[model samples]
Target: MIARVFGASFVVTILSLVVAFLYAGWSGVALCAILGILEISLSFDNAVINATILERMSPMWQKIFLTVGILIAVVGMRLLFPLVIVWATAGLNPVDAMDLALNPPADGAATFADGSASYETLLTDAHPQIAAFGGMFLIMLFLDFVFDDSGVTWLSPIEGPLGRLGRLPGASTVVALAALVTAAQFAADDATVSVLTAGILGLFTYLVVNGLTGLIEQDEPDDSAGPSEAVKAVGKAGLFLFLYLEVLDASFSFDGVIGAFAITSDPILIALGLGFIGAMFVRSITVYMVRAGTLSEYRYLEHGAHWAIGALAVIMLVSVDENIEVPEIVTGLIGVAFIGAATLSSIWANRRDAARQSASPVAD
Candidate 1:
């Protein structure tokens, strides 16, 4: 198992470096390595949550997630998506924007020829949007998990409709329509509007993927080793869990994708570095959860990761329109606290069970 894990990591690392070197020369390799380490460190809980969901999936879906899902995440999200946003909004010619990203601009330039802003400026400018999305996303997540009530909750106004709509086929269509309207509204000149569009894109992307994947696997059996009744219950739970994990992964990747602008805007490099390393870690952690059965054993770990995701989502959303901020370090610390507490609880539960068993008479 360790060998398999090591092999997967090594392959992903090599892919990241190859893409990095091809785009940035020798320096790119170093950049890729650094990004890989950073991503791996930041995404441990993401993997745990993913694994919990994956364990409840059929092997076919698992394979699709590892293969096709990774491609969409790495290439679609980290690389191509950003470039398309810049081209559409900034009015910069695609090739020029590509060149500017590959080679760093002169010491100080606010806007590229296409009128697209610098990565730093653009990302900094977009923070509010990121924050807003994060905030809304987290609020919804938390309220869904904690409240357990249909109405009178903290986010009753939005959550009530969203939860109901989210259960329907039309949610993705509504989001897409919203995105089109958002883009058209800023047809003249407004990077802020474009940023808003991007955030919506991320949100809709989650809904679309979750909805589609859920539909595809709706009829499949749950897991390989669990019981039939457990499978039915866990299958539904796993589907919801999978949806949450995917969104959580996207949320975690948001800042990193934006930060990659600072490293080099070469969309290819950005995609490769973030995609290979980030997706690899996500997959590894997902597999680790299934293989280890951590959720069943630890019990509260999923709760911890979800809570962390909820918090990060809130931080990102609230800051979308304002400068409200929370560091990633804080996010990690919060998750660790929850997991540690859960672990202690699990240990206590195990000991109690052991004592109960020992106290019972044996049929010798």
Candidate 2:
């Protein structure tokens, strides 16, 4: 099991180094290697969450996520997504945007040829809106989990009440909106439109994903699904889940992409280092978690993952403050701490359960 994990990391590191060296010599190789590790550390929670969803999926869908889905995640989200954002924010045509992206001007210089904004300025300038969107989306995710009307309670003191309140469908939205309002202050006054629009879109993304799932999975009135019907439903249901997973993956990757820029303004290197290589390892970790039944074995693992996400969402929102730069390692450690504590708790619970079972009367 460790070998599987190690092997994946090893292969990804090699690929990252090869790409990095080809691009910017040994320095690039070292930088990309660091970015790869950074990606893995920051996104460990993402892997856990992905595993929770992936384990329930059909084998074929699982493979799809591992293979084709990784490509989309790496190229589409990591590469094209950043470029598209630059184009839209900079208000440039495709060719000009591509040129600006490939050749960013010096800091504070015009990004566009006509002493206009450069890709780095435009991209970094777009951070507040990005943070707002990603932050709102993740907060909604955390809220939904805590507010679930389930009897289970990991952090009962807080989660129990939240679960009760979550019974009201509108509750999560309200909370997310409140978060947006607080985060909006971080955006430049002029960026009000961007922040609000992006934040709302984040909320809408969650709603649409849920709405689609409910639409497809809802039972028909006065009718029961037959075997064939059930089979078709199963396929459709997995598709909804796939959509959810992709959105979730996107949300998780948002901060990573932004952070990658801090390492290097070159989107190509960012794609190779954090996007491509890191994505491969993340997919591998998800598959490993699923196959290992880690969630089932350590029941609190999911809770830890969600909690890590909650922390991340908060950090991302507050990160608009230049004075408060949370170290990347700090972010990674937060998730690791949660998971580590949860693992210990799970072990204790398992042992106690075993003891109780042993003490109970044996059936003849």
The CA lDDT of each predicted structure is 0.61, 0.79
Q: What is the alpha-carbon lDDT for the whole of candidate 2?
A: 0.79
Top of the candidates by lDDT: 2
* Model 1 whole-model lDDT (C-alpha atoms): 0.61
lDDT (tens digit, per residue) of candidate 1 on 1-364? 8567547767877867876787678887877766666666667666766776677565655766777677778876676656554565456566765665655556657676677567556545655555445444444444444433344222346446655656654553454445334433433344457546655655565556555655655655455555743353234444554555556666667766775655555566666667887677768777767776777887656656656666565455544433344565676677667567757877777788999999999998
Model 2 misses residue 50 by how many Å? 0.7
Model 1 TM-score, 2 decimals: 0.71
Task: Report the error of model 2 at residue 349, Å.
Answer: 1.4
Candidate 1 lDDT score at position 107? 67
TM-score of each: 0.71, 0.88
> Which candidate number has the best TM-score?
2
TM-score, candidate number 2: 0.88
